[model samples]
Structure formats: structure tokens, C-alpha cells
Target chain A: MKVPALVVQNLTKTYDNGFQALKGISLSVEQGDFFALLGPNGAGKSTTLGILSGLVQKTSGSAEVMGADVNADAFNARRYLGVVPQEFNFNQFEKVIDIVITQAGYFGMTQAEAAPRAEELLRALDLWEKRDQQSRLLSGGMKRRLMIARALIHGPKVLILDEPTAGVDIELRRSMWAFMKDLNAAGTTIILTTHYLEEAEQLCRNVAIINHGEIVQNTSVRGLLSQLNTETFILDLNESLDAAPLLNGYAVRLAGLDALEVDVTKGQSINDVFTQLTASNVQVRSMRTKSNRLEELFVSLVRGSAK
Target chain B: MSPARIQWVAFSTIVTKEIRRFMRIWQQTLLPPAITMTLYFVIFGQLIGSRIGEMDGVGYMAFIVPGLIMMSVITNAYANVSSSFFSNKFQRSVEEMMVAPIRPITILAGFVAGGVARGVGVGIIVTLLSLYFTHLQIHSLLVVITVILLSAILFSLGGFINAVYATKFDDISIIPTFVITPLTYLGGVFYSIGLLPEFWQAVSRFNPILYMVNTFRYGILGISDVNVWFSLGMLVFFIVLLGAFSLWLLRQGKGLRH
Candidate 1:
């Protein structure tokens, strides 16, 4: 049988202060899959990443990368995994090129062998121009890109990004998304944890939502989105309406003088709402979802798990 | 590459990076010790030595040179590792080493090697500075090399341990100020321990720095208050004990891991 990219079996972590961070969380990611592990803050997402990367020890159970146990075969396991932590952990005084090249050295590559790869990654990430500059001198977005370059220097089979674009601007965030999509397409398995639900919806093929140290939901993105019984969209009308619009078999309410909120159930065609709106003499200007679909699902799942 | 070769590459990489870190800030790492040692020679060797005359049948200036060299080696070695490792901890850059596939021993050795390099580097600079103050002589080349290298190893390990337990910037400074400075001064870097009364002389034996100084003095002046063999044994013993303790701490994930 082919080995999974990452596997966790009954993993648990309890801190020294008697607080349990993880409680027997199990997960698996197939090779070359784009996976998302979503959780609210203090929901064990970072702790799970910490355990898998050998930064934090597990109190019980096990985790493996490419079938190599993290505890018993850490060297081999780590050889297959790369982690971009939530915080910037490289030396601020070191040059960008040095940081990426040094990381490759830690993986046992000579400077001669690491230089070309470091250069290529830097160029790919648009950081080659800033290669000679100290890391602290780079902009926030550039620093984030430098971290990605450093993590990818060893060319690991599995990459875990813990909020890789946490504080980035929209343009930079989109560019990072495109880069990550290309990376995933090239057969590198990616597991990301992000607060931005839109990123998870757009990028991840499968996802696991963790709440209070447990896996609350694990399913393909399509399956999870399919579970949504209804979706709400807001429509801006060209003409102001004094009263709420009444549409047969659809719940519609006037949100503002010129806006309407409509709830469309699963299996109900959105075309029905347009037909009803046209018949009611409402001319729509623009339309948008009230909230991201995955975000709604995430909030509901976390609330259910909390209870 | 083979696994052994890979381990060597990682080890060398750490050492090289560490060396570069210090060299990049030469004013902080290399220059201060040279300036400090030169002041010591002027105050203690030139200004006072002429008044005190010869010590143990040698010129007073010549007598104190080895101890001063050893003193430089000891302090710089300890300071280099302590400050470097503690800064790595504070900045969280040590996470790079923690997550690597390198063995624990290799990590420990890398930091220790960096400390040794700085220690020995400063020692060489101090030795060259002492030359203008006095005519230096080595009683035994073997002892001179052994004592200098062993002292560097011993204190580098000492510095590594200090960094392990340190949680704050002030914590790293406390041991060097309260502990290392006093021990080094009382270690007989200037005068012979025999000048003290029998009771004080006995107390001096327990100070590890005394053995290091006296043995290094023996290497230079052919005179020592303590047995040379016994001093060598103590140096080796401390190196082993401290090295083993350091390796254990790394494996336990003491300061670097969680």
C-alpha cells in the first residue's frame, strides 16, 4: 500500500500546567493533496503542528510523516516534512540568502549544493532582489516569502504552513495563493491552518476542523459545503422598495431601502429568485454572499463541538 | 552522501555559521577582550610589576602572562556561548536547529566549537598584546597546547549550561558577574596561592579555576602551586562531566525545545 503523506493516530498533548492541548486527534492526508486543518484560536491547531514537527512532545499516541514515526524515527520523519511556523524564527541580522541556504545546510546539504536551490527558490518567491539585505530590513510580505523559501529549501515531500499569510495585504495574499497552488500541483503535499475561511474554500481539497482539541469534522470540501442546507445572498436593487418583497417558496426580506436578503435552500435554483424579483418589478444591480460558505459551516461546527 | 558525511556537513555548517556570526561583529566579540587584556597588562604588569619585582624567581610581568591568557580564554569562551545561545533562545532562532535532522550531540558540539573558536581566538590576540609588556617563554609546548585547548573546551561547556537555564537577559549576566568574575580573580591569576596562609590555601584548591590557572602557569613558568598531573585530570574530568550534562540537556529538550 502507498504511504500517506501524513498520519496521526490518537495523538494527545497535555501541558505542564495541567491544561490539555490535544485529546487524541487523528488525521491523514494523501500524497499531493491540498489539505486544510481549520480551528479557532486555542483550538490545538498550533499544538498539533508543533507535535508533528517535533517542537512539542506528544503525551500519548503517535504521528508519522511518510510512514516514519515522529518520535521513534524523527530524523527520517523530519527529512520528509517542512514547517512554516506562525512566527518568524530566523535570525533578523542574517541576510535573506544566508537564511535559506543555512536551512538547507541543516538538512545536510553542502553550501555548493544548497546555493543553486536557494537561489531558485528566492527567484521564484520574488525575493532574489532582497537576497543581500538583512531579514529585518525586508518588508512584512517579503519576510513571509523569505520564510517560505527557507522552508522549501530542502524540498520536503510534505509542507505545513501555520497561517503563512496571516498579516499580508490582499494582493500579496493572492500571489502567495497562486504560488502555493503551483507548488501543490507539482506534487508537494500541503497542509495549511488559516483563519481566512475563503482561502480554505478556494484552495483545500479536503479539510479537518478542530475544536477544543478534537477533530470535529473531517471531510472533502465539496462534501462539507454540500452539507449546508441553505445559503444567504444580498442583492442591491436599482429601485428603492418601501415594503419587503414576497416571493413564493423563498424567504426574502428587505435589508435596506434598495437591498434585499434572500435565502436559497440547497437544490433550489438561484434562477427562481431572479424570476421572482423580475416579476416583482425589482431590478438587481449587484449580488454577494452574506458570508463565506465555509465560514458559516466552521462556526456552526465549532459551536456544536463546544457544546 | 552517506549518513556520516551528512552529519559532518550539518555539524560543519553550524560551526561555520557560528564563526561567521562572531566575525561579523568583531568589535563586540574579538576587540573587547584584546582591549581588556591590554589594560590588565598596563595596570598589573607594567605599573605594579616593577614595584613588586620578580615572582617565583621570574619577572612579575612574565609570571602573570599565562594566567592572563588563560583568563581571557576562559571568560571569552563562556561569554560567547552563553550570549549566543541565550540570544538564539530569545529570538526563537534556535528552532531552526531544533527541527533539523541533526543529532543532539552535533548541535551541542557545534555551539561548543563556536565558543572554543572565539575563546582561542581572543586568547591569541591577548597573547600577542602581552608580548610588548614582557618576554614570553613556554616551559613545555605540550602543556601549553593541552592546557589552553582543554580550558577552552571546559568553559565552553560551562557557558552552554548557563545558556540552557537562562530565561532572561539578566539571567545570563548574573552568573558571569556574581560567579565567574569572582572565581577567576580568586583563581590565582596574578599571585601564587602559596602566598596565602594554610587555611586560605586549602580553600583555593576547591576553586576549579585555580587548577586551570596554576596548570597554565606551569606550562609557561615551569612553576605551579598544584600538581600538574592532578590539574590535567581535573580539566579532563570537568570536560567530560559538563559535556555529558550538556548532551543530556539537549536530549531532554530543556531550553531549546518547548
Candidate 2:
């Protein structure tokens, strides 16, 4: 039988001041899977990743990385895991390459053994030119890539990235997405927590959504997204419209003077809406989903769990 | 790699990083102490020692030499670990070790060894500098080496504990300034405690630094106000005490793990 990449069971955390961060939540990630763990702010996402990284001690529970229990055999457990935290956590005074190599050393690699791996990861992340430069001088996006290189230097089988692309520019975000896809395709099991729902939708095959310290939904992205029966899109009108017209009896509303909001359900042809809009003399200059499909389902699930 | 080798490599990495940190900023870490001790030698050993004549049976300059070197070892050892550990905490870069599989003992030993490096490095520099001032003879190199290394280890542990509990910059310097400095001055570094009144001499005996300073003086001058054997035992006691307390602090994760 193939062992799971990660297994967290009945994890709970309560801060000293009485705030419970994780309420006995449990989840698993399969080997070689690109898994997304999504939640809003204060939704226990970072707390979960913290526990897995052994940064925050759990109140009560167990976490295993590649069949090694974290508490019982930390060396064995951490050997298979690589973690990129949300915030930049390297010594600012250290050079870019030094940070990556130092991390390799922390995993027991010699300077000679780590040097080539550092070069390969640095070049892959487009940071080889800045290898000798101090990390404090790197741009925010470059710093993010530097951290990714540091995490991957040890070549762990499981990689957990917490908001790795936050504050990164669009182009870099796309490139990072490509890098992550390549990492995943190369059989690295990745568990990612990101605010950009579209990024999750694009890169992840499996997802778990948490709300109020509980796992509200967990399944394959396709299965969970398939539950999204309706999608809402905002259309840009060529001309100002004070009121939204009935478009093939689809739910419609006026979002702004030059915008119309419409809801489309599954199995409905978008062409029908275009035809109805043309007949009503409302021409849309552009169209986009108000929220991505996964986002819509996430909000509804979180809201439902709240109620 | 075998587990033991991996652990050894991990330990060496931490020590190497710490050494690089202090060495990279030589202006702040190394240069100041050498300069400060030179000033001490000039002002106290040359300018004033000529007037005061002899202390115990040795010339005043030679009398204060061992104390000054020991003083440098203690201060540099304490400052090195305290500042480095606290800075790592402040920057949150200490998380690098927290996330690694290294044992807490390995981390503590690495930091202490780094402190010893600076402490011993400064001791050697200060000792060489002392030779220009007065003629010197080694009484017992074994005692001198033992006292210096153990004193360095003890104070490094002290600094590590301070950094663990410190939340602000001021907290790191508070103990060194208010406590360590005053105790070191009263540790019979310059004047023999025999010059003190009976009651005052007894009080000075309680100062732990007195034991360390007196023992190092005994190593260099072969003269001590305190019992040399008792002083050696006291140094060992303090090291064991501080070492245990330091390991406990790491285990508790005070001001460290959340």
C-alpha cells in the first residue's frame, strides 16, 4: 500500500489567552498530489501550516509526514517535508545563496554537497545573478523566489507553501504558478494555502476548505467545484445602463451605471444571454465572472458553515 | 548519511553560521573589545599602577593583567551569545532552526561554542597585549586554560538564558550593565580582598565573579585571596547550574516557541 504524503489527525490548538485556532481538524494529502488548503483570514490556515512545520506546538493531536509521526520521530518526519512560510524568515544580513545553502546544511548537507544544489535552485528561480547579494536588498518578488529556492534545496518529497505568492506581481505570479506546476509534475507532493482562488483552481487537483476552525469541505477540486450550481458574472456595457433588462429570464441586476450583474447556472448556454442582450439593445463590451467558480462555492460553504 | 553524522553536520552548521555572523561584523564584535582593553591597560596598568606599586606580591600591572583578560573573556562571551540569540529572535530567523530536525541541545551547544570562540579569541588577544606592559611568567597553564574556557562556557549560558527571556533590546543589556559589571568590579580584579575590612572581605567572598577572578589570578600570579580549591569547585558548580538552567529554558521554549 502507498503511504500518504501527510496525515493530520484530530489537531487542536488553543492559545494562552483562550483563543482556539484549530478545533480538532483532520485532513490528509496523497502522495504526488497538488493539494490546496483554503480559508479566509483568521481561518486557521496559517496555524495548521505552523503545526506541520513544528513552529507552533499543537495543543493535542498528531501530524505525520510520510508515515513518520512528527512528535515521535521529528528527524524522520521533517526529512520528507519542506515548508515555505507566509512571511520572509531568513536572516536579512545573509546573502541569497548563503540562505539556501545554510538551509541545506540544516538538513545535514555539507557545503560542498549543497553548493551545486544551491546553484541549480537559484538558477531555476532566476536568482543566480543575485546569489552573493544580501537578502535585504532583494525586491519583494525576488525575496519570495529566494525563499522557494531555500525550501527546495533539501529536495523533500512534500512541500508546503503558505501564501507564497502574496504581494507578488502578476507576471511573477504566473511564473511561480508555472514553477509550482513543474514541481508538482515532477512528483513533489505540494500542499498550498493561497488567497488567490483562481490560482488554486488552476493548479490544484484536491482541496480542503476550512472555516471557523473546522474543515467545512474536502474533496477533489472538480468534485467540489461541480457542486457550484451557479456562477455570477459582471458584464461591461458599451453604453451606460440605468437598469438591467431581463436576459432570457436569467437573474439580472444593475451593478453600476455601466455594468450589469447576471447569474448563470450549469447546462445553460451563454449564447442565449448574448442573443437576449442584443434583442434588448444592451451591448456588453466585456464579460468576466464576478467571482471564480471555486470562490463562489467557498463563500457559500463558509457562509453556510457560519449559519 | 548516518544519524550521528547528520547530527554532527547540523551542529557544525549552526556553529559556523554563528561564527560567520560575529566575524562578518568585526567592527562591532571584535574591534571594540580589543580597543577597550587597550585603553584599560593604558589608563589603569600604566598610568595608575606605577603609583600604586605592587598588589599581593606582584607588580600592580601584572596583578591586574589576568583579571583584565578574564574580564574580557566574561564580557565577550556573555555579549556574543546574548546579542546574537536575541537578534535571531527579533528577526524571527531563529525559525530556521526551529523548523529543522536538530535537537535543542545541539542548538544550545552550537551557540555556546560560538560564544566561547569569541571569548577565547578576545582572551588570547588581550593576553598578548598584556605582555608589552610587564614581565610575565606562567604559574600553571592548565589552571589558566581551564578557568578561561569554563568561565566562557558559564557566561555564554548566562547570555543564552537572558536572550531567551528578552523581548526588547534593553532587556538584553540590562543584566550585563546593572548586574555583571558591578559584580565584576567587586570581584577583587584589581585590589586583593585582603585589603578589605573583615566584614567586607566576607561579603566579597559571596560574589561568584570573585571566585572566577581569584582563580584566574591564582593561575597567573600563584596568589589568591580565596581558597583556590574551593574557588575551582564554585566555578564548576556555577557552570553546572547555568548549563542546566539553559537546557531547561530551551525545553520550556520560553519567549521562543508559541
Candidate 3:
């Protein structure tokens, strides 16, 4: 059997103040897989990443990267993993290219070998033009991209991005998403922790949601979404309604004079609701889901775990 | 590349980055020491030494030259590493090194090397500045090289320790202000310890900086109030002890890791 790209077994972390941040958290990511780690604030996602990257020591348990134990074989383990932390950790006064090239050097790449790689990543991230500028001068989106470029400069087999697109504009976020997709397509295993559920649902094949230092839910995105028995969508009508509309065996609530929310169960289609609404002489103008399916599942699972 | 080669590359990269950091700010890192040392030469060596005439049978300016150079070396070396490492911590950029594949010793050595570079660089600059005020001769080139290099290494390690324990910018400055400056001034940088009373001379022996300054003085003037061999042994002892202590702090991940 092929070795997993990353693995955590019963990982636990308790800070100096006796506050436990991670509690027996276990997880694995296969090679070439795009995985999402979802959690609320302080849910151990960053802590787990920190442990894997050797920034935070684990209180107990073990983590392995590309079959190398993180604690015992740290050099080899780190050799296969690249991390883009949630914060901008590079020296702001350093030139952009120097930051990326220097990061490659930290992994043992000589300047002769790292320069081309740095250039390539910088160009791919659309940061080549600003290579000589100090990092402090870059825009927020550019800095985010620079961090990604720095992480990729070493060409590690696995990449872990902690909120890589946090605070990014929609356009820049989409561009980064495309770039990451291309990276995954090139066979780099990626583990991402993000608050954007839509991004996770769109990009990741598998996901694990943690809450209160425990894995509350772990499954393929498809599997998790499939567990949702019903979905609610909002519909806008062409004309204002006088009162609530009756539909056959369908629950509907009037949100406004011209809008209504309808709950549709599994195996039922919005077309069926349209058919019933047409029979009631209500013409629909627009329709949208009340929330992303993954978001709904995340909130419910986190709430359930809270109890 | 082999793991050893990779480790070397990482070490060299950190050293290079640190050197570049200070050099890039040459006005701040390199210029101030030269100007300050020149002022010391003008006031203490020229004006004060002219009045004193001679110290320990050597011309006063020449006697204080070695002490002045040693002072710059120690202060610059300590300042470089302490401020640089503390800045890395303040900016959270040390995480880059903490997460790298390099061993903790390599990281410590890299920062120390940067400190030594700045220390030696500033020492040489100060020595050249002293040339205008006094003619200098190297009494023993071997001693000159060893003492200067050892002083740089010792203080660089000292600076590394200070940086490790520092929690804020103010903490980094506190030691140099309260401890380093006083010890350096009292280290017999200006006056010979032989001029002190018996009890004060005994007390000065306990000050580690006195050994460093007196050893460098012997290197330059072939005159030392302290035994050269004892000073050498003390310098080596402090280097080993502090080196080990700094390495221990790195391994413990104190201040740099969570």
C-alpha cells in the first residue's frame, strides 16, 4: 500500500495555562488529495498545523509527514511539507524575491538552484513584476500571494495553507483558487484550513470539521453534503403576494411581499416547487439557496458537538 | 544534496540573511560605531591622554587604542545579535527558521556568525579610526587575532542569550544598558587596573569584561595587568559555557516556539 502523505494519531496539545487545545485528534491525508480542515475560531486547526510544522510542540501523540515522524525525524518530515501560516511571517523589509529565494535556501536549496524556482513561482503568482520591492509595500492580496510563492519555492510534496485567502478580495481569491487547483492537479497533496465554506466545498474532495478540540465530523464533502436530508432556498416572486401561498406537501414561508423560502427534501426538485407555484399563479423571478450546503452541515455538526 | 550539505546551506543562508540585514542598514549598524569610537579617541585618547602622558610606561593614546577597539567589538557584536534576533522574534519572522529543516545549533551558529561579522567589522573600522590619533603596532599578531575573535564570539553568544530571554524591545535594551555598558566602562577600558587600589583591583578581576579588554590590550601593547594565559582560559570558558547555554535554549524552544 502507498504511504499516506500526512498522518496524525491521537494528537493532543495543552498550553502552559492548562488549557487543552487539542484532544486526541487523529487525521490522515492521502497523497495527491485536496483536503479541507474546517473549524471555528480556536478549534485546534492552527494548533495542528503548528505541531506539524514544528512551531508548537505536541503535548502527546504523533504526526507524520510523508511517512517521516514529525518529532523524531523532523528534518525529513519537514523536507516533504511546506506551510503557509495564517499570519504574514516573512521579514517585511526584505525584497520580495529575496524572501522567496531565502525560504528555498532554508530547505537546503542553493541560490543557483532556488532562483529559477523562485522566479517561476513569483511569475505564476503574478508577483514577478514586484520582485525587487520590499514586501511591506505590497498590497494585502500580493502579500498573500507572496506567502504562497514562498511556500512553493522549495517544491515540497505536501502543502498546508492556513486561511490562505483570508481577507482577500473576491477576484484575487478566485485567482488563488485557480492557482491552487493547478497546483493540486500537478499532484501536490494539500491540506487547507479556512473559514470560507464555499471555497472548501468547491475545491476539496474531503473535509474534517473540528470543534472544542475534537473532530466533530470527518468525511468526503460529497458524503457530508449527502447527509443533509433537506435544503432551504429563497425564491423571489414577480408580484407581491397578499398572503402565504399553499403548496402541495411543501413547507413555504413568506419572507417579504415578493419573496418566499421553501424547504426541499432529498429526491425533491425545485422544478416540483416551480410547478406547484405556477399552479398557484405565483411567478418566480429568482431563486437561491439559503446557505451553502457545507456551511449548513458545519454549523449543525459544530452545534451538536458543543452539547 | 546530502543532508549535511543541506544543513550547511541552511546555516549559510541564515548567516547571509543576517549579514545582509545589518549591511542593508549600514548607516544604523556600521556608521554609529565608527563615529562613537572616533569621539572616544578625540576626547579620551587625544585630550585626556595628552594630560596623562603615559599609562603603564606606554603612550596613553596607544594604551587606550586596544581597549577602544575591544569596546567597539564587544558592544557591536552584542548589539547586532541581540537586536537582530529580538527583531525577528518581535516580527514573528523567527517562525521561518523554527519551521525549517535545519537543526537548532545551526540556527544559533548562524546568528552568532552574523554577530561576529558585525563585531569584527566594527572593530576593524574603529581600529582604523584610532590610527589618526595614534600610531599602533601589533605586539603579537597571534594574540591579536585570537583575542579579537574570541571576544566577538563570546559577546555574540551573550547577545544570543539576551535575545532568547527578551519578551519585548525594552527587554533587549535593558541588559546592554544596565549590565553591558557598566561592565564595559569598568572593564578598565580607559584606565589601567594597576592604578586602582588593591581591593578595587581584586574586585575588577571578577568582572569578565576586564579579562577580555586586558587580553586584547596584551595582544596590541604586549602589556596586561592580568595574566594572558588566565585571560585566554577565561575567554574560552565563557565561550563554551555561553555557547552551550544558547544551544540549550534553542533546543528548549524558549521564546522562539510555542
Give per-residue CA lDDT, model 1, range A206-233, as digits (tens): 9999999999999999999999999999
Q: What is the lDDT of residue A12 in candidate 1?
A: 93
For model 2, how does the per-residue alpha-carbon lDDT over B1-258 read when each residue is reduced to its tens digit?
777777788889988998998899989988888898888889999999899998888899999988889999999999999999999899888888887777888889999999999999989888888888877788888998889998999999999999999999999999999999999999988899999999999999889998889889988889888787887787789889888888888876778777
For each candidate, report its DockQ versus the true two-chain complex.
Answer: 0.78, 0.73, 0.82
For A76-193, candidate 3 gives per-residue lDDT tens digits of 9998989999999989999999998888888999999999888899999999999999999999999989989988888889999999999999999999999999999999999999
**Residue A210, model 2: Cα distance from true site in angstroms:** 1.1
Model 2 per-residue lDDT tens digits across residues A1-307:
8899999999999999999999999999999999999998999999999888878888999999999988788888888889899999989999998898888888889999999999999998999999999999999999999989988988999999999999999999999999999999999999999999999999999999998899999999999988988888898999997777977659999998999988889988678889999999998999998878888888899999989
The pairs that clash in candidate 1 are none
Write down the worst ten-residue block by lDDT for model 1 chain B: B1-10
- Ranking according to DockQ, highest score first: 3, 1, 2
Model 1, native contacts kept? 0.70
- How much lDDT does each candidate structure score? 0.92, 0.90, 0.92
**Fnat of each prediction, in sequence:** 0.70, 0.68, 0.78
Total clashes for model 3? 0
**What lDDT score goes with residue A98 in model 1?**
90
Cα distance off (Å), candidate 1, residue B36: 1.2
Clashing pairs for predicted structure model 3, backbone only: none
User: Can you give the lDDT of residue A208 in candidate 3?
Assistant: 95
